[model samples]
Target: MATEKLGIRVERNPPESRLSELGVRQWPKWGCEKSKFPWTYSAKETCYLLQGKVKVYPDGAGGGEEDFVEIAAGDLVVFPKGMSCTWDVAEVVDKHYKFE
Candidate 1:
């Protein structure tokens, strides 16, 4: 069977130049979070992690197997609308996030 992937889309070490070129910083910034918690996205979101590490587990509410995605500083991540996930922040999590 073909496994289904949901929730996250990741781009490793996206070029800093690309970040500036796309004006990613123009979006509002979210401060570093020291605590881990579950988050549900009400809308599609794209973000750039400025620091820290995180592991996000899908709770299987999106019609696929439960799985996890690893995130870290310099990674660009996209979260689909209405996705349910638990975030296990392994370190201080800092990022800039914007909702669609």
Candidate 2:
């Protein structure tokens, strides 16, 4: 008897990220320098670095903002539902992500 490994990739943005004007919600994999977007209350996302680095900042207004969290190769970060933040990729980045 023999066994085999199997896998599949699902690229769909969470409902909140989907625009009503656009019937389908898809976040394709790509490389970029930096990106910024407002996270909706319903969206949840996770990111894994396959090449470069990224800095994540959680939403809040305060005297002193928290330091940026660096995410590089082999690093994983989870953004939960209702969480809002901005993501900045200081170095070119290639990543695999799935949202729901």
Candidate topping lDDT: 1
- In model 1, the clashing pairs are none
What is residue 47's positional error in candidate 1, in angstroms?
0.4
lDDT of all predictions: 0.79, 0.51
Tens-place lDDT digits, model 1, residues 6-82 = 54788878888978876789888886566678888999988888998988887774523446888889888888898
lDDT of 2 at 87: 64
Against the hidden reference, what TM-scores do the models get?
A: 0.82, 0.55
| Residues forming the 10-long window of minimal summed lDDT in candidate 1 | 1-10
Which candidate comes out best when scored by TM-score? 1
Clashes of each: 0, 0
lDDT of 2: 0.51
